[model samples]
Target: MGENLSRRSFLKGAAAGTMSVAALGALAACSPSGAASEAAAPAAAAAGEGLAETGSYDVMSQMSLLNRNMTEGAVAAATPEEFIVQKGDGALQFAPGGDPLGITPADFMQNVPAWLGEAPEITDIAGTESCDILVIGAGNAGSVAALRAQEMGKSVILAESQTYDEYDEYACDMACYNSKIFLDKGTPEVDPIDVMNEYVRKALGHVNLQIVRDYAFRSGEMLDWMMADHIPAEYTEKYAKTSNYKGNENFSGQCAGQWSWPAMTQWRDEETNINMWPFVIRSLHTSLENLGGKVAWGYQALRLIQGDDGAVTGAIFQDIDGNYQQIDAKAVIVCAGGYGGNPDMRLDLSDSMRNLAWAYGADRTDPEMIGGMGRDGSGIRMIMWAGGTMEAGPRAGMSIGKNGAPGFAFGGAWPCFGPEGKRIYNESMYKFGSNGHLDLMPDDSLLVNVTDANWETYLSYQGYGHETMDRSSDYMVEEVRQNMADYQTGPDGFPVRSFARFGKEYSNVWAADTLEELADIVGYTGEAKENFLAEVAHYNELCEAGRDTDWGCDPQCLFPIKDAPFFASFGATGGQPSNGLVMLSGVNTDGQYRCTDGAKAAIPGLYAAGNTCGNRYGIQYGTPTAGNSCGFALTTGYCAAEAAVNDLA
Candidate 1:
C-alpha cells in the first residue's frame, strides 16, 4: 500500500481502459524472423513518438493526476491519534484510540520564531576600516553632518535605516517648524534675546538661564547660515506671513511690541519655498557624494562599539538583508529624533505623556500620515543602551482625543461645541494689546444657575456654545433641563427627545442656567462659586458702565449673563502638553558640538547637535521665534563637520 508507483506502471494501468491503435500497431510491428533484431531495434521509441505525435497526454494532465494521488495518500495517512490534547487540569493526555508514541501537547509546541536568526558567528578577525568621521542616522542632521565634513576635506560615511526614499520623510515632508506659519505673513520679528528668555521662562519655569541665553544668541546666526547656503529667502518670508506671532505675543508678555525684524522677515510668504529639511538633505547628500563620502542606506545601528577605557570607538549595524557590518570611525553623531513614536518609551520617560495621538492639523484619517507606523523611540533606547543619561525636562505628550472624534486638538484651551458642531474658545481671551496680553484667569471660576433642578439639567446638557458666542444660552437651557429629568427619573421614565451627540462622551456634558443654580450643579459648596457669580454680575454692571475696574476685561468684549437660564462653564488652568519647543540646557560642547562627560574635557572625536546638544532656549512653548529647530540642526551640523576635519588633520 505504501509502494512508490513507477511512471511505466501508471501508464500501463491508464492505457488498460483505453487501448490505442498506435499501441497495437507498435506491438505488431515486431516480426518473428527478425524478432530479436526488431525487438531490440526501437518499438518503445516508436510508441513514444506516436504518443507524442498524437498528444495523448499533456504534462499538466500528468502532473494533476500525480498530485491527486499524492493528496489522497497524505489524507489516508493522517489519523486522529496523531493529535495530542491537553486536559483541563493541566495534565497532558495521550490522543484517543491508538497512537503508540503518546506524544503530549507540551512536546508538540515550539518557541516563537526568531525573526532574525542567531547572531552572526564571527570567524574572521578583520581589522576595522578607518574613516575621518561617521554620521549616524541619514536624516536631516546626519546628512548635513556628512556633507559639511566632506566639504571640509574629511572622509565621512552616512548610515541610515531605510533607503533614502523610505527614510524619515514624515519630519522632512511636513513644515514642522512654527516659522512656516509666520513665513506666510508679510512681516516677521527678530528679538532673539527676549524670544530666548520668554521661551525658557514659559517652557522651563525660568530655571535654566544659561541655556536660554546661548540658544537665543546663536539662533539668529543659525538663520544667517541657512540664508548663506542659498536656502530661498522667499520660504522664510512665507513662514513669517502665516506665523502665529500674534498668538505668542498674546500668551507671553516678553514679546510685547516685538515685531519681526528685517533679517527675521524670512517667514512672510504663503508657499512651501525655503523649508530647509528637503533642501538641506538633498544638497548635503549630493555634496557628500561628490566629496568622496559614502552613503549606506537600509542599515540600522544596533549598538555602539566602545574601547577598553570606555571611550566610544565605532558601531555595529545590521543591513537590510540581515548582514552585519562594523563601521569604524573616529567620531559618531547621533541625530535620530525624539520618542514620539514609541508609546512604551513615552510612558517610561513620563507617565502623563502616554497618549498616542497625532499633532494638531495632522490627518489621522489619512492612511499616509507621517510617523503613522510608529518606530519613534529607537534613538532614546539606543542611547540608553550606550550608557547615556537622559536630561530632566518637561514631561510632554499630546492629550487623549475624544474617542471616534474626527480630529484631535491640543488640550489647555477650551474647545467650543454646540448642539450641531465644534467651536473655538473665546476669541477676546486671545487678544494682545500694546502694553500686555489679556490672559484668561479661570482657575477658580464656576458656572452658576437658578434652581437645583435647573442646575442638574444644565450639568447634563449635550449642546455647547457657538465658536464666536463662547456661550450658547438657548442650547444650555434646553440640554440642562433634559439632563436633570433623566437624572431624577430613569432614562425610561424621562420624556423622549432627540439630539445629535457632540464630541466624545466626556465632553458631551455642559452646565448653565441662572448663575446661582449653575454654581450648585458644578459642586461649589463654599462661596467660591457665589463669589465668582458676584464678580460676573459686577463685570456685567461694568459693561453697562462701559468700563472695567477690577480687571481690564474690555466692556465691549463682555456679554451680560443676567438673562433667565444663565449658566457658566468652569474654566481651568493650564495649556496643551509640551512638545519641547524651545531648547535649553544640554550637554556642554565646543564650537564643534562635542559633548564632555564632566570628568575631563569632551572626547576628541564625538560631536553633538540639535536638541540633544541643547543650550538653545529655556522653557517656553510655541514662541513666535520660528525656524529655531532648523537653525540649530544646520549650525550644529556645520560645527560638527568642522571639528571632525580639524581632528583628522
Candidate 2:
C-alpha cells in the first residue's frame, strides 16, 4: 500500500506536469510510519491537497529549480528533512534516492546487471595460446602495457576487439610535468606536490594519494621513455618548443578558482599537423611484434578463467570468426577503458550524473556513439565477476561542457543564463565544476550564453588547461567563422550547424541586432524574456562598475552587452549535453595497479590500468593539468606491467 501510494503520488506529479519540491516531498513521504515520513506529512498533505483542489500545484516549483530560480537561502529553507539522506560520511542533501535510481548499493553490487548476463560456459575451445602477461584492450593503456612488458623480456599478448583501423585515433595530448622536453625548452618547473594536492582537493580525498604522488614524480620519465623509441624526436622537440598558450595578457596558472599548469604536451606531427598519438601507438605495436609479442586483433575477451584458489588464470575470447579461443596467462591487465558505453553501468554507478545524462539524451548504450566511445565495460565486468570491487557510488566522469561546436569552450568564463533567464554559476569556473552545476538543472533544460561583439576579448580571459586559447585570437576567430559560415538554413529558415559525424543538426548558435530578437531565437518567452533583458541590464551595470557584484565573476571576464550583433550559444539544444571524451572512474585499485578488495588488499593475478583503474579521481573528474587522463593511462599501464613482471619474478 505504501509503495502504491508512492506510485500514485508520482503519477499525480507527472500528470500535474510539475515535479516541485513539495510534490517530491509528498512522493518521498509515501513510505509509511517512520519519523521521516511523519516529519514529511504536512508538506505532503499541503502539496496533495493543493493538487487535488486545482488539478495542478506549482507555487513552490521554483524551489526545485537548481539553476537560478531560487536563492541559496530560499533553497535551504525549502529543503525538507526527508530529502537529506544522512550517511556515515556526512549529510547528503537533495538525495531523493539514496542509491542510483533508488536501487540500494548492496543490491547494485550483488546483482549482475542484465546487460552483463551470466558468463558463457567455456565448453569448447577451438584454439589455445599462452603468455606471461595477457593484456586486454589495445587502447592507450593496453598498448603501453604490452610494450612495457615485452620490453621487460616477458611474453605478452595484447588483444583488441576493434580492427587496426578502428582503433587509430586517440587522446591528442599528453601530460608530463618536468619532462626532458620541457626542461630543454626552458619551461618553468611546476611543483608536482601542488598539483597532486589540488587533485586530492578536487577529488575530495577519494583518490589514492600514493598513486597520485607516483604519477606526479614518475610520469615525466615514463613519457620520456614512451616516446623515446616511438615518436620522432624532432616532432616532440618542435611541439615542446611551440604549443604554449597565446593571446592571453593575464596569463597565470589559475583560472575560475581552478589551478591548471601548462604541463600537457599536444602530440602533433610537425609534417602533417595530425595527431601523433596513433602514430606512436602504431609504432609501439610494430616494435612489440618485432620483439616477439603478439597483437591479437578482433578477438573480444568474454570472461576470465579462475582457478580453484579464485585467482584469474586465463581468459576466454570470441574471435572474429566467432570461434572460442583460450589464452592462459600468469597475470592479466584489464585496460578496456571505462564503462562509458555501458548505459546500465553508468546509470547504476553515477547517481549524480543521471539528470545530466537525461538532459542531453546521452543515456545511451551504443558503444561508438556513447560519450565514452567504444567503452563497453567488458574489461571491468570481467574483473568484477572475478571478485574485483568497483569504486564507491557517485562515480567520476569527464564532462567538459558543449563539444562539436565553436561556442564557448570548456572553462570559458563567459556569462551563461539558465532556462529561467538568470545567471547560472560563477562564470569563472572550471568546465567540470560548471558542468557539475549544469547537472543539477532540470532535465531537458537549455543553458544559453549571450555575448556581444567584443566576445573575443572576453574569451581571452579564460586560461584553464583544456581551453587555454592556445592559438592566436585571429586563428581562433577565423576557424570559428569558417565553421559558422558553413551553417545551412533549414526549411524553417533557421540557420543550423550540421554535425556530419553524428548525422545531427543543431540551431544552437544565433545572432541578432537586439536582445529581444536574440531571446526569441533562443526560446525565451513572456516572463523569461523579461528576465533575460533584466539580467543583461544587470550584467552591463556590473561590467560598467568593473566588478561582478552578484556571482563574483572575474573582472576581466565581465563584458557589457551594449554592442550589436549579439550572439548566443545554447547547450542541450540538440537534446544532448557534452560528455567530454571519456568517463574517468573505474575499478578500485592499489598503487601497484592491482585490483583491490573491500579491505584494499590486492587481488593477485589481476591488474588494472588506464580508465579501468579507479581511486584515481575522487567523486568527480577534476585535474590540475589537461591530459592527465591519458598521462595516467600511460604511466599506470607501464608501471602495472613492471609490477606484474616483478611479482612473477
Candidate 3:
C-alpha cells in the first residue's frame, strides 16, 4: 500500500525540492553531518555563496527532501519503483508537505494499551497455583509458548479469557517455513539471511534488528518441532493444506496454509469470519493438555506483580466465576492479541484509525465500521505497566488490502466506479501491482464502489462466475484475454449468494436495473450521474479502440459495459481486505523476547510472544508474502519459550 500523493504533484514538488536540496547541501557544509559538502559548495559562495536565489524550489521542496540525493530519474525507465519508495506508503508515512514523518516513542505505543490506573493491592495474598511458566492468552502465540515450555517438562498454566465454549473471534492460515512438512512436500528450506535483509530493506527502515534475527535463524527448527511432535497426527491432514505463496519464485522455501473455500466458507460468506488456524489451535490445545499442562479457559489477566529485585514475580487474573486467580511462576509470557479490537486504544494511537476500526456492534449508520476480532491489548498494557518499552517507528504492522467491498480491480483495470459513477483512479495506476491496495481502497469520504454486470462478468472470468478460480489455474489466466475479445454472458441470473452475508446483512451492497436508477439508489447526484454516463460511454469507446486514451486501461482488460439486470455488492475485495485482520503492534522487547525497559534493557521475568512483541514488523506487514503474521506468531512464541526456560534455569 502507498500514500495517495499523486505522481504529477510529487514530480512538481520534487523538481522544486531539488533547489532546496542544493541550498540545504550548501548549508550542511557548515553543519555537523555535511562538513565535506561545504568545501564542494565554494562555486556557489563565490557567486554569492548564498545562491539562495537559484531554482524554482518551493515549500513543497522541503517535504520532498527524501529525494535530495536525486538530480533526475524520479520515474525513469529504471526508476518508477523508486518514486513510490520516496513518496510513501500511506497518510501516516509521509507528512502533508511530502517529507517522511520522524519516528517517535508514541508511534511504538500507538496500539499498546495505556496502563490501568487501578490502585495496586499492596498486601500479599497467599496460596496460589504454582507453575514453572505462566502463560496468558491462549491464541496462536500463547498456545505455542505454553506448549514449548511444557515440552521442557515445566509445570504450565495456559489461561484464556474466553470461556470453554467460546473460540477466538478470528483465525487464518499460518505462515512458516523449513518445517518437516514443507520438506516432505518437496518445499525447499528458505534462506534466513535473504528473508531477514528483505525485512530490513522493505518493512523496517531505521528500526532495531535483533528480534527478527532471532526468529529468522531458529524458525525452521521450531517448525520441525511443530510438525514432528507439537501437532497431533489426527490433525496432520488439516495442517498439510499449505499455501506456499511465491514459493515458485524468490520465496521458494516459505509457505503458509491457505484459506480454502471448504475450510472457511463461513469466513468467505462473512457470517462467521473465522480462519483455518483453529485446526492447529485445537491440536495445540490437545497437545498441551496431553503434556500434563493445565489450561484455564476463562482467565482474564489483570496485571503483573513486580519484585523488590525488579524481576516479575507473578500475575493477577480474574477467572470466569468472578474470583481472583493468582498465579506464581518462574516466568510469565504475554501473548494477547494487539489492540485492533480496542477503540479507545486505537483512537489514542491515531484518530484516523477510529474510522477504520470494526467496532463492537457498529451498525449500518456507520458503514465504515465492523465488529473487531477482540484483540484488546490487555497483555500489552500489563507488560508495559511492569515497565516494558514500546518499539519505535518503523513500528507496528498494518494489514492492507481491499475491505471485501465491491470496488476497483486490485491486480489491474477492470474499472471501478468512484463517488460519482466515474472510474475512480487511472487504470494505469495499479501497474505497480505491489502496493495496489493503497490505490484501490475507497478514496471518497464514503469509500464505496458501484459497478454493473460487466464488472461481475469481468471478475467471474477467473473464479466461479466471480471469485472462485484459483491463482494456480491456467484456465483462469487465458479467460481474461478471451473475455476481453468476447465478453462472457452475464451469469444466468444474479447470484446473490456470491455476496457475503455480512455485506447483505449490513446493507452495504445494492442493485438496480436502469443506469439512472442504479445511480440514484447508490447516491450518485446530478453532476456525478452525468459524469458517470459520460465515463461509461468513453470506456466503451476505449474498449473498441483497443487502447486507453483516457486513463490507460490495459489493452487486455478493457472490457466495457452494455448489459441490463446489473448487480452491485460491497466487500468485493480479492479476499477480505487486510483491514479486517488484527492490527499488529506491541510492547518493545529484546533479543530474548524479554520486555525491555525504557533504556532498552531486559525487564527480568517478563517475556512476550505473538503480537504483544514488536520488531518482527515495521509500518506494515514485514514480508510482502502473506502468512508472515501467523508465522511470526508461531516462531516468536517458540523463541520466547526457549529464552524464558533458559532464564528460569
Best model per TM-score: 2
Give me candidate 1's TM-score against the actual structure.
Answer: 0.47
For 1-649, candidate 1 gives per-residue lDDT tens digits of 1245333343454456554666445434431222222222222322233133554422222211222233343433244444322122233222111111222223322222122113334434233465768787766556767877777777888888887777544332211222333334433544566555545645545333443454555544534554446355554443432222233222222212222222122221112233344433455576678779988788776766667765667667777877777788877776655555543344444322322223334343332232212335444444444444444544432222211111111111121221111121232232111001111222232222122222322222211111011121233335434553443221122222222112212122323445555555545556565555665566557657865454454333334445554433333222323223222233445445665544436654566655455444432223233344445555566566666677667
Candidate No. with top lDDT: 2
Better of 1 and 3 by TM-score: 3
Report the number of clashing residue pairs per model. 68, 3, 19
Task: Please tell me which model should have the higher TM-score, number 1 or number 2.
Answer: 2
Instruction: Give a tens-digit lDDT track for model 2, residues 130-246.
Output: 999999988888888999999999999999988776767567666777776666656677788987788888878888787788778878888788668765666555543233433
Task: Kindly report which residue stretches of model 1 are placed more than 4 angstroms away from their true locations once superposed.
Answer: 1-129, 172-189, 204-214, 230-280, 351-375, 398-592, 596-604, 614-622, 626-632, 639-649
Measured by TM-score, how close is model 3 to the native structure? 0.60
